[model samples]
Target: MGNVFDNPSFFSKYMELRSDYNYNDYLEHPAMESLLPPLKGRSVLDLGCGYGAYAMSFMRKGSSSYLGIDSSSHMIEKARTENAGAGISYRVLDLKSLDTLSTVFDVAYSSLVFHYIEDFDALLRNIYAILSDDGVLLFSQMHPLLTASYGYSGYFEGDYFAFSSYQEEGRREGRWFKEKVVSYHRRLSSIMNSLSDSGFIVDRVLEPIPREEDIREFSQLERDLVRPTFLCIRAIKKKSK
Candidate 1:
C-alpha cells in the first residue's frame, strides 16, 4: 500500500484529490475530532500520517509532542518541508514496525489507514504496548460495507447499492488513480473483537452522516445518507491488572 503512494503519478493524483474538499474533509475529520480527548500537554502518535497534514493542528491544540509516521519516504520528506514545526517530528516507518517503538504516548490517532494493514491483530497489540495505561486510541477506516465488495463502483444504481461479499474477508484488489491497490477486508465484528483482544475498551463508534450544511455545500455527499463511507472508533488502552 505504501509503495503505491510512492509512485509519482499516484502520489500526485492523491495530493490533488486531498487539496480539494472531499469526504475526508467534510465527513471523516469532523467525526474524529469530535471523539478526540484533551490534548494539552499530552504526547500524540499518528499512524500512517501522510505528509504530516494534521501534525501542526495537534500541536496548536496544546499537545506537548507529536510524532507522525508513514511508510512513504516521499510523504515524510514533504512533511519535513511543508508541515514541520517545533515539537513535531515525522518518521518514515511502516505500521507493521510499530513494535520497534519504545516510546509510549497519551494518544494514538490514525486516519483511514488500518484497512491497508494485513495483520490487524498484531497492529493493535503493538499499539497497546506503546500507549500509556488508559491512553486513547482514535482511528478511522473504510466502512466494512464499502470495502466488502471486490470491485466497488463508487456510484449508486438508481436506488440500489451494489453490495456483496460481506461475509468473506480477505485481500481485495482495486484500482486507484489507475494504479492497482490492495487492501484487506475485515468484518466490523472482527475489528471490535481485535481491539478487545488487544486490551482496548471501546468508547465510541461513529458512522458519520453529512450535516445539512455539508450536503448543501457538496450535494454528492447525499449518497452517504444511503451508506456510510467511513467508520470511526475511539477506544482506551485498558489498565494493566
Candidate 2:
C-alpha cells in the first residue's frame, strides 16, 4: 500500500477506533471546532474528511451543501454507510488532485490532514482557488514541535518523516489499527510562509492544550499540556482587488 491509510485492515481498525479518546477526541476535535466559523447556509468542502465524522454536523448546522473528500476508498465507504444526511456527499479523492475541483465553497475544513502531504504550497493554492472570495479555510496538522522531536530532542531539527502504529488507551482497550502511518514534518515558519505565498491570509494559529476536563478523563493528556501535539489554523482566501 502507498500509505498506511490505504491498507484495508489498518483503515478498518481506524474506523473502529473512532469512539476512543486518544488524539482525535481529546485534543484535535475541540480545537478545530473552536476555530470554525459560522456554518449556517454555507457551502463546505471537507478535504481529507476521513469517515465523514463532521459531515452530518455541517448539514445539521444548516450548510447548504457539504462535500466530504478523502483519499481512501475504505474511508469513503464507511462514511457513506455510517452517516446519512440530506445535503452531505462523500467522495474518494486525493489531496493533490484538488486542482480538479470546480465547485466553489464558502468554507473549507480539514482536520488533522495536511501533514501527510509534502507539497503543502500547491495544496493551499488549489484550496484557495476553490474557495469563494473571503471564504474561510480551517485546518489542523501535527505540530512542528512534536514532529521535530518524534520521541526525542525538541530543538527544531528541520523537516523529516515520522511513522506510527495506532493503539488504544484512556478507558478504551484494543488495537486501534495495525499499520505504520507516515507523515512529513516542516518548520512552523515554512508552513506559515507557504500559506502566505499561496494567497491565504493567516487569521489565527492555535497551539491546542488539553482542557482540564479532558485531562480528568484521560490523565495521560497532562503531558500534552506541556507540549501540544497539534496545531489548528484559520485562514481566509484573500479578496481579489
TM-score of 1: 0.96
Estimate the lDDT of model 1: 0.90
**Regions of model 2 farther than 4 Å from truth:** 150-178
- In Å, residue 218's CA in model 1 sits off its true spot by 0.9
RMSD of 1: 1.9
Query: For candidate 1, which ten residues in a row score worst on lDDT?
Result: 151-160
Give the clash count for model 2: 0
Q: Which residues of candidate 1, in runs, are more than 4 Å off?
A: 153-160
Model 2: per-residue Cα lDDT at residue 152: 28
Question: Which one is best on TM-score?
Answer: 1
Q: lDDT value for candidate 2?
A: 0.77
lDDT of 1 at 175: 76
Identify the leading candidate in terms of lDDT: 1
Local distance difference test scores for all models? 0.90, 0.77
* 103-177: candidate 2 lDDT, tens digit per residue: 999999999888778778789888988999899999998776555433322212222233222221111111224
